[model samples]
Target: MLTLPQLRALYPEAPAAHLTAFAAEAARLLPAHGLAANRQRCHFFLAQLGHESGGLQLRTENLAYSAARLMQVWPSRFPTPEAARRLAFSPEALAEAVYGGRMGNDRPGDGYRYRGRGYIQITGRETYRALGRLCGLPLEEEPGLADDPAHAVTIACAYWSWKRLNPLCDAGDYAGLTRRINGGLTGLQDRYGWLERAQRCIPWPEAGSEALPLPRLRAVQRALKARGFYDGSIDGIIGRRSLAAIATLRAELGLPGEGLDAPLLAALAA
Candidate 1:
């Protein structure tokens, strides 16, 4: 039941420098469309940057694609030899070509999987279709956002606007975005839950506050807290209060829920 101001107050002070700057920008740019936490996208983007860019920029001599890790073959990665030469000069753009479908993350030829690139990690041909609709660009035709950091982030923001796909987004309403952005309920958000849990026992931003120590981070936290299944305040930090309440609810459902992440989204979506 925490207001944005209250929720924000719980944020632990974080050092600024790397992600802090991006958080400010993400916060500033996101609210006009009504995304709640600046730290949310900032947090998500920084994590992606870590996975995509090796934390700073491309290694230059290295490539994400290889003969063994090949997913798709391209007749020409660049529009022309000149374009290829152009990419060769910049470590950044070369990474883009590789991630933007030109390079291929997963190469069945070499057993490589399709790992999308760019700040947001745009992967697979299907990803281009969704991102294209949101960003007003033909990702298929241009297919360059994977390496283009700014464009990748911009398109990701457009994708996270929420309820445009779900039509019911409010703060904590991750369902719609999760469903579409992840391409179904059990995609990115779902995997991230486990991976995030494994990484830190919970998904905390690199430099921000924590997810409510409450149960499944759905809008239901708001309602359940109101109903007492969640004694945790409705601030959405995914803390103990929320988790305990979720366990109780799952037992009541007789549905074999994990009481953690496995069936939380399904229970809520159901």
Candidate 2:
């Protein structure tokens, strides 16, 4: 449902290829993951995604830092300038020094090996193994796959789901969500800016409407088609084919009725 133009507006600095891939993947995966369930969820998800991925431009963590930068970023770890200078510009050494004994990085090279990747910057060996199981991908064995654009969104969505962060979004708890995602309030203002921009770009459903808007209906149609429950053209109209597809999906999920409601949307998304 997120248009290409809207995505471009959201991430003007992203490369054209990255924008295209992210747009397609978001359209397919966001709804499927229930991240697009409502305006709040969509805006919150995009805000965090934009902030974490640097507006969808970065798939891997940048460990290269100057001594002054290192001193500022990790003051507790590198208290003095001389200490920071030792690992300055040495990404692998810095990674090892800071991340070696934490986040399930016990092996010699596990620091760099399990460094952050993907849209949300998934980090750590334990996280990679867990997400790999959720996504059915060998992320722990081949961490670089998280850098691939196709897999990045999947990893992000899986991470979001695994963390069960949607309720915070539903509760409008941006600070709570940020803490869960970043372990702190880092870049909180920037995330709020993205959320404001997303709110302006993406419209919410009007109250008292039984049928979804055209764009959302089209998204549902696409989801149904992907699941082989619908074979009709995705014209955004709730025609016989669409209804039949919904009916079939409801039957499979053991859900009652053929109505378009929150439960149906959630089921289709699931």
Candidate 3:
């Protein structure tokens, strides 16, 4: 399960309250969508979601941009500033122009109404409807729920499950997954960076299991001691002293008093 401390480390700029809520929501929702089956799936999902949602800070897609940026990002749609200027700085107008008459959005103002929202930015009326059906939610009727952290995590996990991204994630096919999620290699480097960061934060463990092996536990204790979090014997046993050390470290790091969790192990390793 993800912890607030891990989320805080991943998104240092995000508010602490937001990270707390996001961690709780992730722990609650990810398993239901089968995203907590393994560490690889968790890491890959978090990396992509972290990148897409701007570390769980951006629920709605920011469409506001200069004409030059519009042309650069959507060259096919805006070949020049003369063509892009009308849509520039007008997020709602841009949404209507680009997303209208597509993805089952044939209404007058469906684009702006169904603009991308959620951790993975589930866009379009059809997508919302389909995800609603898949996840047994009222996303189509209440699209704004995507902006809520709880629903955003659920929507992203549902999308990930529907796409069968775990195998690709296990295969380390980030480019392929990126193409599937983004329809192109946009922000590939940033995605890679997020992946690296997630790997560092999550580390390795058996899927769905929280029990750390003895050797691994000893290694973690050693790591903590090296980082001045623990100053006890590293005998592969979590003794009272070790637990006290862990509590002290948690207090020092502003982590919750959840003692010796996967996040602590990851932090110790880092």
Best by TM-score: 2
* Candidate 3 structure quality by residue, lDDT tens digits, 1-270: 888788788877765656777787886677876667777677778889888888877878878989999987788999988999998999989989989999999898889889889879898999999999987889889998888755666678789988888776654456668888988777766877787788777766664433343466678778878878678877555656777787788887788745566677677873
- Ranking 1 against 3 by lDDT, winner: 3
* lDDT of candidate 1 over 1-270, digit per residue (tens): 112332122222212232343344554555654444444443333333333333424311244334322222232444444444444444344455555444333333211123445544555555666677777777755666445534544565565453253232222223333444444443334334422332342233445433322243547577556556876655444445766777778777776734344355456652
Alpha-carbon shift of residue 262 in model 2 (angstroms): 24
Q: How accurate is candidate 2 locally (lDDT)?
A: 0.81
In model 3, what are the clashing residue pairs, if there are any?
none
- By lDDT, is 2 or 3 better? 2
TM-scores of the models, in the given order? 0.37, 0.72, 0.72
Clash count per candidate: 27, 0, 0
Indicate the TM-score of model 3: 0.72
Candidate 3: count of backbone clashes, pairs at least 3 residues apart or interchain: 0
Candidate 1, position 154, lDDT: 58
